[model samples]
Target: MAKRSLPILSDGAAKKILRDLCKQHNVSLELVTQMIEIQRENLGRGRQIGITQDFSAAIAEFLDSASIVRGE
Candidate 1:
């Protein structure tokens, strides 16, 4: 059998996923927005590229840490 591949999400789709996750988890949208801004700043003055995975990873990590902190 051939290995299955995941489809790449568009930027808007990825943002929506992050936003929804925040809402579902009771995480503040403001914090998520700040996290996104921090990621963009970290990318610096180069052409922005491959942001989908980075954004998703940031949200996932933030959620993980938040849960750990809250002992959820």
Candidate 2:
């Protein structure tokens, strides 16, 4: 049997990839970082039962509006 290994990404590489993705998507890295922080805070608040419905709804609304703005 042949063995295969997955390629590992360093922190710099990961950050560059994320930056490239943000650029490609026409979104600012700061906006993406803020979204991540919001999600993290929600997860902390709802750790016992997972993310709250309100948080999920907010995320859905955000995505919906983003798509609308981008005409996607």
Candidate 3:
């Protein structure tokens, strides 16, 4: 079997990607960061009881609703 190498991004590149994504979505970096933390916490809590959910999609929907509510 051939060994496969994983792609890596430098810290600067990662930050740039995040910044661009936030700009493209017209959302503040702080808001996105907070949502990510909340989603992670929820996922962790769910895992304690062996519950699994497609939280990524849920988070996206939440962000959309939040943006609409904020008139963004």
Candidate 4:
């Protein structure tokens, strides 16, 4: 699949999304927000956050494995 760009977010939307992700993952949104801020800064400077694509692919692969295991 082709890579896609995610947009910059206002504080509210970013916080909301981060909160939802953290809740789903049983993580702390504060920590996730730190990472998001860093990613945003890197993206703003036109530097690709290296390995993000690979990371995404890896997550997809992991989920695919689970789905297969579950006969999904």
Candidate 5:
């Protein structure tokens, strides 16, 4: 199977997603970078990006968790 290009996310949105994920997972930016690399590598082997369904949901979930953590 061949891989396809992923939908391009806005830089701001992507940065926010990464930040929220790091916070939610109690991980550092370095770990987030690693996780993202892992995610990309896993998907690319099968010609995909992140799980289409899971990616947005995961980001949303992370943001929700971050907001709660911040007492928002």
Candidate 6:
């Protein structure tokens, strides 16, 4: 069987979908906004670490941060 691929959405399209889903489900848009901010920060950090060629450090940092956020 051939592998299937999902369609990539632009930022506006993705945000609109998320906003609609959130509204339908009575979810808070602020929560969605925070999630996006966290992801963007992680991406920026990863890009910075990539320039330094420290993927292991990046993985460790991400794991540590995630654990802290989850109160693990």
Highest-scoring model, lDDT: 1
Candidate 6 local lDDT, 1-72, one digit each (tens): 442332222377777887798799765555555544444445536354443334344546656876798799
Q: Which window of 10 residues has the lowest lDDT sum in candidate 2?
A: 1-10
Off by over 4 Å in 2: 1-10, 47-72
The digit string of per-residue lDDT tens for model 2 on 1-72 reads: 432321222367777888899899886665665566555555535363544564566567767888998899
lDDT string, candidate 3, 40-62, tens digits:
55553635342234445556776
* Residue 55 in candidate 3, Cα distance off native in Å: 11
Best-first order by lDDT: 1, 2, 5, 4, 3, 6
Better model by TM-score, 2 or 4? 2
C-alpha lDDT score of every prediction, in listed order:
0.66, 0.62, 0.59, 0.60, 0.60, 0.56
Q: After superposition, which runs of candidate 1 have C-alpha atoms over 4 Å from their true positions?
A: 1-47
**Residue 44 shift from truth in candidate 6, angstroms:** 4.6
lDDT of 5 by residue, 9-65 (tens): 236777678778868978655545544645776653665655555456656666687
For candidate 6, the per-residue lDDT at 51 reads 32
Better of 2 and 3 by lDDT: 2
Question: What TM-score would you give candidate 5 relative to the actual structure?
Answer: 0.36
Candidate 1 per-residue lDDT, tens place, 1-72, comes to 442322222367776787788799888666667665656455655766766666777778877888899899
- Residue 61's lDDT within candidate 6 is 67
lDDT of 2 at 52: 54
lDDT of 1 at 10: 32
Q: Assess candidate 1 and give its TM-score to the true structure.
A: 0.37
Question: What TM value does model 6 have?
Answer: 0.36
Error of 5 at 48 (Å): 3.2
Q: Write the per-residue lDDT of candidate 4 for residues 1-72, one digit (tens) a residue.
A: 543444433467866876787789865554454456546555545657564774465556656866798799
The local lDDT score (0 to 100) that residue 34 gets in candidate 4 is 48
